[model samples]
Target: MMEMILKTKQVSEELGVNPSTIQRWVKFFNLPCQRNEHGHYLFNEKHIEELRKIKDQLSEGLAMTDVQIDIPKKEAVKTKEFTLNNEIEKRLDKLIMRIDNMERRLETKADEVVSAQLLQHRLEIDDLVKKINSLENTLLEMQEKQTFQMQDYHSDFMLEKPKPVKRSWFASLLQLFSMIKS
Candidate 1:
């Protein structure tokens, strides 16, 4: 037993606990031990092997001297808190991403609506221009017909008029005065 020894770190690793925990147990429980010249605990291999058996027995639901084998309460609480924080962070990230996507979609829909309104307005303007052109053509044709009718009337009036007869100047002057009065 004196030829074999285990360090605190090695013992803690095998026991699946912190070295400080083992140190507390050793101090509080008054575990039988011997210190080297450096004042460090020196444990025999057989002693550690025996402790392992006791730990395994406790793990199998056995109570040694009424000492429960439950994990430390503080560590379990901290672990639960860490898990909750991680879960909340993940959900928050997802929610923010969803909101961003919705905002982008809304912008796209607004752009589409604006584009449709612009297209509708353009179509109305084109239709109005076409109607105006048609009306202008109709007005031009009406004016041309009126001009031709006036020219035909003038030609007919000229054909019906009698030529001036060879007469005294006084007689022609009297006929012109009579025509002006009529």
Candidate 2:
């Protein structure tokens, strides 16, 4: 069976807690959770149960600092940025293809109302496309920032090879004689 993973927003809604509060809980409680490449929390059902228990405890006057979280040890999900991008792109492509097919079918119907509705839906899809573009841009910006940070880290911390000292012929001969005597 495929395991289900919930996003932060979904988890918050499920637990009837504010999203920010949930984020704070995750931070303060050190809840073990998976994060997407963009650093968004990807929660499993166990996380939801844990959060619910935490919420109940807090509601019962338990101190936030006193409450402890016990997340079960599990392998983390490996959802890389490129994989997410490819999946989203594939879904968008399918949606566009469906829209194109619908448009083609609607063209033969000769119904003005249906045509207007299709236009509205197309506009909505265009809005989605714009949002996807904005998200892609954000991902690109994040990748650029990470690259620059890594570059800075390497520049600041990387070691260089020391240059060999140049010696005159007299100095070399004296060192050789001293070694020969020894």
Candidate 3:
């Protein structure tokens, strides 16, 4: 089977590295490559494997100068997976923050609604209090009028002279006797 060959751009994409880095790797690390007619470097699977090994060693805290190109056991790249997970976490965090903001806004709106209702109730209470005061004042005026009328009736009744009562003849005889005695 023929080996699959890829251009510099394709290698850059596969390695998740810059095309310049791949070119530098070709020059500095002596990365295996074939020159096309245009003198552009073409990479094969072997070169990709060696790049993966170098990347692994770099990730393991080895300096670029210290990294060896010899292929270790083949393993999947962790950077891509790590990037995806990081992105997902970031999105979830944003979503959580948005939800929290919405909740706060809803709470504020609810508080405003309650405040408005309370204000309306207070207005109603104020109106009721005013009406009650008006009624009380009217009642007080009515009472004052009734008390004046009672006082006037009482005074009028007292102003009238009482009629004299006729005494019995026996009571008149007793009175005449008493006058004689005096």
Candidate 4:
């Protein structure tokens, strides 16, 4: 069995990363590691080999998503004012223009709905007018027949009931006197 002996600094130097980064990764990913009686970390040879391969791949310019890290630093911003601002402004303008166009389309759709409703209402009104005209024609024919019947019937048959006969004031006085004498 080959003796496995390596320090944090040795691995850090080999990987071209600070020892703290390796320590953080060890803590975060829970890699297989042992602590000596002095409480110093000891990684096996296989773990060291795996870390070396990962470091090699990263140095060869792999995408950040593929690599495992505690926290990644932001990509360095290129020192330029005009291009960066212009790019942001262009994207913002495009977003605003797209929103405006969508709003206009929505407004047009709403107007079309209102127009359709108005057209429907007009159609209903036209139908109601047609019904009214048909009813008027019916009423005229019925009225003509009603007039003919009225003329055919004797007016006396439809006369109001005659009022009851009323006694004269003198007869009413004489009847009152007779009742008093009795």
Candidate 1 has its poorest 10 consecutive residues by lDDT at 68-77
Across 122-158, the per-residue lDDT of candidate 2 in tens digits comes to: 9999999999999999999999999999999888677
For candidate 2, the lDDT comes to 0.81
lDDT of 4 at 97: 100
lDDT of 1 by residue, 96-155 (tens): 999999999999999999999999999999999999999999999999999999999999
What do the candidate models score in CA lDDT, each in turn? 0.71, 0.81, 0.81, 0.71
Q: What TM-score does each of the candidates earn?
A: 0.38, 0.38, 0.45, 0.38
lDDT of 3 at 135: 100
Among these predicted structures, which one has the highest TM-score? 3
Model 4 CA deviation exceeding 4 Å by range: 1-84, 155-182
> Which lDDT value does model 3 have at 125?
100
Per-model tally of clashing residue pairs: 0, 0, 0, 0
Q: Per-prediction RMSD in angstroms?
A: 16.8, 37.1, 17.3, 19.9
Q: Candidate 4 on 105-170: residue-level lDDT in tens?
A: 999999999999999999999999999999999999999999988876747556757789899999
Tens-digit lDDT track of model 3 for 1-182: 99898999998899899897778666556554789999999888888888778778877997555676663324322345545554665688899999999999999999999999999999999999999999999999999999999999999999999989989999999999999999
- Residue 13 lDDT in model 1? 92
TM-score of 3: 0.45
